[model samples]
Target: MSLKVVVVSWGQLTNVVREVQSQLSGEAQIELVEGLFDQQTTLEMARQIEASGQVDVFVSGGGNARMLRHNLQTPVVAVTVSGYDMLKTILQSRTGDETVYFVHFSEIIHELNDLKEVLPFPVNQVALKTPAEGEAFFNELSRQEQPVVIVGASLAWDLARRHGLKAVYVYTPKAVLEALERAVELARVRRQEMEKTQRVQAILDFACDGIIACDQQGIITAFNPAAEMITGISSQGATGRPVGEVVPSLKLEAVISSDRGLFNQLERIKDKEVMVNKVPVIVRGEPRGAVATLHDIVTIQKAEHQIRLKARREGLEAKTTFAEIVGESQIIQQTIAQARQYARSEATILIMGETGTGKELFAQAIHNASQRQGQPFVAINCAAVPENLLESELFGYEEGAFTGARKSGKLGLFELAHGGTMFLDEIGDISQAIQIKLLRFLQQKEIMRVGGQYTIPVDVRVIAATNRDLLAAVREGTFRADLYYRLNVLPLHLPPLRERKEDIPVLLRDMLFKANRALARYAPVIAREILLHLPAYSWPGNVRELQNIAERIMALALTANLSEHQVQELIGMVLQQGAYEETVKIKAGDLSLRAGERKDDLKKEIGNLEKEVILEALRQTRGNKTRAAALLGVSRSTLWRKLREDIS
Candidate 1:
């Protein structure tokens, strides 16, 4: 009943705008806004319209409507020439039993074809791009003694009419009447049905509580926005999939057996305690779908904590500082120096490192070191949120941005990061459209909300991080080149754990001490042999893997009184398993071997095995030939000579 509508037209088309507005007078509140003068200003006009904040549905005539719709989130209803309008014009024409040529824009030919199928008279179609083209075509039609029906929306239609050709504008009387009737019927039906449906859907969507609806057969029929927000799975992908497949803890059978509503709290989903309300959606005394609403108990508490923190931050409470960072390695020192230098200048900083290498730690350190440190430090993972929701997460949205959007609306990360730093993690994973918007924000220091207007100026520093090679991504066309250049103003690369071998002992001692304190146990002495092996093994998972291994060792020492020898035994078992798997693969013919050879093959195989062993020893020693030669139990010169002979 309270639908807001905007009528976009040229100032000269006031009469036409009033006619259309009158039709929806009872159903919606209509506001008229003049759109762009030409196609080139379409995006700017759309932005202007959105900034006014007085429109919901953008009803536009002319070619600019298409361009406007492409730029804005508002539903655009473009008025086009309809089948009935063409038929009416043809029937009223004086020329009869003559070949009628319909001169129109090429894009409207499809609509003309549909009309041809229904009309009784035979008609010929010709596409004209401009008024001059239409006039030339009409002149040829006149020479052939054929009647012409010109259908277009620009000066082409006007010129065709002046040339005595039967011309109908895109929004002709017949087309306008048909469109108005359809709009009226649609508005009435939508108004009546949407009230109930929207209220229920709003509860399912906007509430922090997650709601999932399943049919009698336990097939998920509806996965609401809240459900998606909680599970990190999209509603579209979750629909029709089994409930158990979407969320393992739902236990659909329990609800079916009860045949009544049930309220409970479960701790299995996402390792969080969530309160749930499950009820059967019975229609005509038969259960159609079961609805379950759930809310994370911990998240509610966190929300309260965040509110207090925000208040405290605004009240000049001391915030996290550079002193809070606890690392002393040369790599860390160099990274900190770069962060400090870049903190004063507000250029975009790209922080690149492997996962768990503390890219976020460095980002936070940069924010804390900057002038905007006292404000919010908003961080978002581009890879974590689904593509559809990420727009709202970054730019936010107005109330009712979409079917499941919140009634009160939502604020985005950019808004939250105002006056501070917005750290976009895994920046390479963002979609092209989002990348463009982000690029614009970086260029202009302003953002337009997902379903909003009036670009809000944000005094924010951008810190982006990704483990991906952005230059490679640019070549692959996955990341935008312009956005990359914009963010790459200052680049800081954190060395992987294996490359900084000197830092291993320091990290180990710190992690061990932390683990011992947490476990309430004495720190087990790390044998010199174990410390040597640690640096030699590649830490693919980086610092996180090292921390986990340290914790595991500490747990073993505390619970089973495991010694350093036991740790070595565990490592040996893993290596043996890998060797066994490789041997199995070779025997299974998974690896190709050269055919039609006999004794030469055995000699080749022995040579290959010796080469592999030598290469592995050299790799473990980091290409130190002397250590490799010692491990091979061969003289240094003999090993060198053998390696040279193999190369030859």
Candidate 2:
């Protein structure tokens, strides 16, 4: 850390720098700016050096150093005059014939009389503060002696040289070097102090609590970054103003005047509520200043919410958007329209549908389409988990609450879904004990941990889905009627896939595409009759079953392309696997079967599959005989003859 010392001097003072630099080469760097020892030009030069902001100190001799020190903020070190320097200048400039005059710009060396007695020629000494005094003294001396010796600061020495009189500069190389050493030391100390101040300012700037400091008189001295953020007032506007007037809520004035400090005091800054702490700064048993720290209430709560949800929010998200549900059927379209409207309100939603009717799909869509889309979407299936475990998972549990409780305690699914939506799937299957707790959460918007007493307020939108008949359960005393009413604030019913048969072809095409992509080669092609026949099958598992069937068909198709005949055989196998036997037409004599295989089940499956395929084509053509025959890929007359024959 080499210090930049700008020495603003002319004449002998400027000439001495090279000798001074060689004395101390690496510790300090010196730049000589030739300037006179005066008020105007010298101070202006110092101002320019200070404005550059690279200078550490300004060094000069006599009046210039004094002027710079008095006028500027940057440090200025003066080259001092010693008695030895004076005697040397006087001895060097004199011949026994010429009188020696020593005129100094600073205070005169009081021991000059003693120096006169110690083998120094008779020297007249005087001190001059201004240039006019130096000029008058020089004018008087120029006429008095034909040949004379002059020794003094830059002005006197320079004037004597122009007048053809011998002159010696009083500032020796030793004195100038000493001043440079002082300048270098002062610059190092200031730099270290500045580094310390910057470190403290960095901590204050990044701290969460707003810091405001003031002088004893209550005038603001510092307002950190956090303070500006909380108050919405700039430090430029606040500092140097009275703290009480700038932020009246701080109560800094009272703290400065009194001995007591206020801690955790709630105050209002603009429109926001903030918690404040004010304290008096005391030094040596006397009040020196006051400080206040402000914490915005809303910002604090948001940070706490994030800390609690951080680890639990990883996979708890709603990636299913309204655009993902693919269907153009009127029945499905109506349900979507109603659900979209329901998403706008902050009310509990209860979705009712049969198995595989996409209840969770609709729940996720509503969540993504709502205002809480950016927050977490936590889902839990009530029927899948045991009754006691379900309670702990929904409400959390303190350490030692149960046999396997985590030592650090656990955050509940409801708590993790704070600031967003929570999807409680199979809500009807939960026991009455869990239902009552859910009822409390729905009414008050808060929940208590399993073993903990305090309630935590969770700002979440709850959307519940169930395939069970909740109303029937409530009447039978299995499900609570109060909880049902709470969950059914906004009711939505998703229609089964069979009711929207027109959408089957689209779903089948998408499913086949995905399945075929996984196959990469040798994709199976189903006959056109199988595609048309799908709409007639009473889809017991809805869209989910259709997807499973499509995937299975693709897996089987890797063997060979499946025609209408193969589909009938697959349908027979499919019905037999499911053990469906309502309309059994046992053609036991038909199949060459092993003794272990049942003949009646195969016949019954074939009969049911054939009837559904015939019915699906007729429905798709809207009961028009010719169109139905065309869709079935057969002649109209053959279909008419078959219908008349009662093929069933």
Best by lDDT: 2
- In candidate 1, what residue range of length 10 has the lowest lDDT sum? 519-528
Determine which window of 10 residues in candidate 2 has minimal summed lDDT: 580-589
Candidates' TM-scores?
0.40, 0.52
Highest TM-score model number:
2
Tens digit of per-residue lDDT, candidate 1, span 148-186:
565555444556666776765556644554444544455
Clashes per candidate (backbone, < 3 Å): 0, 0
TM-score (C-alpha, index-matched) for candidate 1: 0.40
Give the per-residue lDDT digits (tens) of candidate 2, residues 1-648: 667888887887778877667787456778889886556977887798799888888888877777788999988899986777766667777766787777777776668768878853567777887778877777777778557788877877887787677888888888888888888888888888888999998998889899999999989999998999989999999999998899886678888866888898988888889998988999888999998889899987777667766767888888887777878899888999999999899999999987678888898899989999888999987866878799889999888898988875788988889999999988977888998999999999999999997999999999999876789989989899999999999999999876987777666766666667543222223323344434244555577766655665665554545555666676455444332222122222222342136655765655455456557657766788876654443344445545753553
Candidate 1, residue 428: the lDDT equals: 79
